[model samples]
Target: MDGLYEQFRIALHQVWQRRWLAMAVAWCVAFAGWVAIALLPNSYEAKAKLFVAFDNMVPTAAAASQNPQNDIMRLKQTLTSNENLTRVVRRTDLNKLVTSDAALGGVVAGLRQRIAVVAQPDSLFEITATSSFAGLSNAENARTSAAIVQQLVELVTSGQLAGDPQRTQQSLTFLDEELRRREQQLQEAEQRRMEFEQRYMGMLPGTGTVADRMAAARTELAQLEQTIVAARSAVNAMRGQLAATPATVPIPGAENAYAGTASGQLAGLEVQLSQYLGRGFTEQHPDVISLRSQIARLGPQAAQERSRGSAAGNGIPNPSHVSLRAMMSEREAQLAAAESRRAQLQADLAQLGQRDSAQPGAAAEQARLTRDYDVLRQQYDRLLADREQLRLRSDMQTQASAMVVRVVEAPRAPSGPTSPNRPLFLTIVLVLAIGAGIAAAFLKGQLQTTFPTANRLASVTGLPVLGAVGEVVGRAERTRRRQRLVWLVGSGGALAASYAALMAAEMLQRGPVA
Candidate 1:
């Protein structure tokens, strides 16, 4: 602590010795600092605030998915997009103002860092912009801020759906197209249903729906009846031929021969049948004798057939009866079937006539088709009605689009310069000057080869500083008195110089009196 005090004392003495140089340096530094502050560009800042409102009146159930806060955020992003910014730049003519001077342009570029956009906790925003200029007026700053707000309003509200006029028209156009398509499809489907109904009018599978089937059956039955008539004519022709034929006798020359032929023919039949003895004929013994007598009578015809055996190609002795009976039976069955078919045809034809008379007329069918078509047309009309209603809603919306923002509190010109903070600058400069003064005192001490204490001198030179007196007390006392006088004079001179500079600056700004 002692050594430090001694060092300080020595530094103070050195500085006092070079007081003129020290003062010159201090004045130079002060002037330089003042010049730097004067050359700095002047700057001004402007700020504005806006309050957002959500004015939709629809009920929550109708728009359950909507979030008003999210909508506001979306709007905020749109306001800041490049597209909106470009519009803002053009409308405010910012480029013109910013580029008019190089310094202003630099200030504009720096504004990106200085400008602030803040959203308050409760859905409000504060927008601020800063501009720097050499000699800007307060009115100019106010005008710039007002213009920026106007441009922002335009950029934000021009295309917010509520302001667009074309949306309603587009919706109407789309609805018209869809309505047309539905109408066409309905017409085609109706036409196809009518054609199908006409082609299959009465040929349906159910018995109750068989009008066409009955007609077809009647026609088929008529054709078969004609065929039966042809068959009956053939039967009559055969009967006529049978009636014109005469019976032949095997023994025609003598009556006795005839009778003997009959008896002999019967006996031959009896003798041929006797080849099989009846095991159960005991009770019918006389009946068997009578059958023998009858067979003996037809034996002559058997003998006649035997005489003509060479002409009989089939070995069966009596094929005439079997072939004639089979042909007769087949003709009878065919005739019966034809008659049955005719009866069935008559019944079916009667049923068809009844059904035809019972069915509704073409007028009624057409009315039914028209009724169905009207129903579909009504449905389509209802849909169109709904769409038209929505279109009216859209049209109304277009007429009442969202409002653009207007200023609640317009910007006003500030009274004071925002830049060149004088109090802060003065404080900083005074502190720096004191530090420089201390440095000068220390540097002077080092350059003068001065020793702070006797011990230091002895230690440095390896010699005793005999009777080293501190600061040469008598000289110091005189210097102290001299220093008091010098400080008074020097401070007075600095005050005069500063007052002169201030007067010059003020004069330059005010100009000479008229």
Candidate 2:
């Protein structure tokens, strides 16, 4: 512990004795460092914050285009693109210095590093531009930073707004041309269908495909055959009932001829005809016409025999038998009509089948035509929808969804240099200079051959030294030493004062003088 204290004391004395050298070195280092720091170009930075909101007012088309992240990504790319940087160079005072293509390219390359675009959540963008351009004043660089940021934003905004309309118009034109082509195709298909039907009108069915009509006709033909069979069975049942019942009931005092009169038979036939009419059989029905013919044939005979049939109340008409015969006639007529319909339907189906077999490619050709028409129709409809959407987008206001950038904070010239941190750096340099000077003085003291302490001398020489004595000086010498001390103190104070001055100068600076 004693040795350490002794060494510390020796070091303090060494520093004090070389104080003048330390002051000179400190002054030189501080001044040189301050000059170098001052000579470095100041980097002025401008910053802007923007808010982007998308409001696509078009109907039903916003869903596919509502991606804010993609829009923000595009904004980032556009902001730093070469085209935007080129525009920035032209719009700012930087253009004056960059006359040649090489100069412009170099400036644009430098601008790439200087500009920064940061995208934040909730559609916020932070745009920062820095300028450390040479041959320009710090104030000019500060202004240029703001101008470049503004120009970049303007370029991006104008680009998004302007390019959309032209592209939309082009799309609309293309869709229109496609629609016309599709329309022409649709007409040609219709013409082909018409000509095909006309050429094979006798064989091919109208209003439906041959197969569909054939299937339908076959189904109906089967149903008609079933109806005909059922009707024939019903007519046979009625005939059996008529066979069981006699046409007339005989009485005790009448002749057999007198029992069955012509009037009564005619009346029975007329009654049957009336029943057929009441049952919704039209006058044009075969049964109804046949009954009318029979009535006509029997009318004159019945007129002559009416009195004889009245006189003989011997035979009376059986109503049940008459009714059965009338019903049988109606059923037989229906069966005949069904048979006729079945024959006609069979003939039509045969013709369709034969036509299809003869042509062999009719169904395939029709199928291909239908398929082509359907495909073209679907494509035309899709293009129509797309065209409508494009029209909506084209009709948007000048500053529409894509041009939604809002200047939350406009870019402005910086009041101070962003880099170099001058005041702090100046203080660091001052401290380092002072430290270097102290180190130099300490090294010089160590280089000397003399030793201030007896122990130090003894340790070095490996000899025994008893002690050391202090120097006794006259009052005048002491005064002289005091004067030297004051000079040394003043020199150090001046160095400190210069450091303070540099710091003050740095702090007082708002920006470069214009």
Candidate 3:
């Protein structure tokens, strides 16, 4: 512990002995550092916030614009593009430095790096511009930063400038031409379809192809056959019924009965029974069974009185038999009509078979042509719709200036430098200067052969050393030491005062920016 303390004391004494050289070194370092700091141009920042609503900018039918990520990215890229930056440069103080194309390119490149556009949630955007052009004054750089942000805002707000005018116009023209071509092609395709229908498919039933019509015809023939068989069975049943019915009714219960009647009422009763049967009534119907019973009851009576019939001596003609015969004839007529339909259907089937042999691929060709026509129609409609939307969009952009960006906060130049942190940098340089000075003095002490103490001297020499004598300061020597001390204090105070003055100047320099 004592050895460490003694070493520390020796270092302190050595540094004190070369204090003037240390002060001189510190002055040199501080001067260079402060001057370098002063040479750094101030970077002024300008910022603005915008509400970017995309709903009104693009049509809802535009599929690519469903997500806003692409739009935001495009906006960011466009704001920093070289053309916009060139315009910004021309409109600001940076225009003075752009003497040629190369100069403009350099300026634009630097400006692009300094500008930042960030998208926030809820369709918000923040645009920032930092200007630190070495060629311009600090205040001018601040003005240029604000101007840059303002120019970008203008670019975004201008409907015509939001997108390329020439490209939009070209797209509209191209779509118009394409739509016209599609219309012509559609007309030609429709004409071909009509001609095909008239020439090839005209003989087929309905609008179906040959095979479809043939299948439909066969199905109809099968159903018609069932109807014909049912009608034939009904006709046969009606024929049997008519043959079983007698053409006369016997006179009932009396001699000299009328020739046209059984007791002059048998024919009327028979007619009523036939009417019941014709109304789709069953044999189980009460009236029909009752009439049959009455007729059977009168049969014996009429046979007993047959010799006593009228002069005509013929039983009344049964209207029931006539009704049954008429029904049978009507059923036969219906069956004949059904047979005629069946023959016509068979002939159609034969004709379809022959057509199939003649043109085997007619159905497939028709289907393909119809499919192509439908697809073309759909595509043409889609193009027409898109062209209309594009035209409206273009008109809105040109005449109405529909695309709008609302500025929530307008861009303004900063009142102070955003970079360099002058106060902190000055402090750091001061500390570094003092540290360097102390290091220099310590290094000088280390290089010298002299030792500050007996212990240190012995340690290095490896021998016992005699005690050293203290130097006696006379009055003249003390006076000269005081003068040197004064000079050192003055130099140190001058450096400190320079730092304070620089700090004060930085504070005062903000007035112009504000």
Q: Alpha carbon lDDT of residue 385, candidate 1?
A: 88
lDDT of prediction 2: 0.77
Q: Per-residue lDDT for 257-280 in model 1, tens only? A: 533444334534443444333345
For model 2, the superposed segments whose C-alpha errors exceed 4 Å read 56-66, 156-403, 511-514
Q: Which model is ahead, 1 or 2, in terms of TM-score?
A: 2
lDDT of 3 by residue, 86-108 (tens): 88888889999999999899989
What is the Cα-based TM-score of model 2?
A: 0.51
Candidates in order: C-alpha RMSD to true structure: 23.3, 14.3, 11.7
Number of the candidate with higher lDDT, 2 or 3: 3
Worst 10 residues of 2 by lDDT: 198-207
In angstroms, how far off is 436's CA in candidate 2? Answer: 0.9
Collision count for each candidate, in order: 12, 0, 0
Report the Cα lDDT for residue 107, model 2.
Answer: 91
Weakest ten-residue segment in model 1 by summed lDDT: 242-251
Model 2, residue pairs in steric clash: none
The digit string of per-residue lDDT tens for model 2 on 1-81 reads 987898889988998888888888898899899999988788999988888887765545544544567656756865676
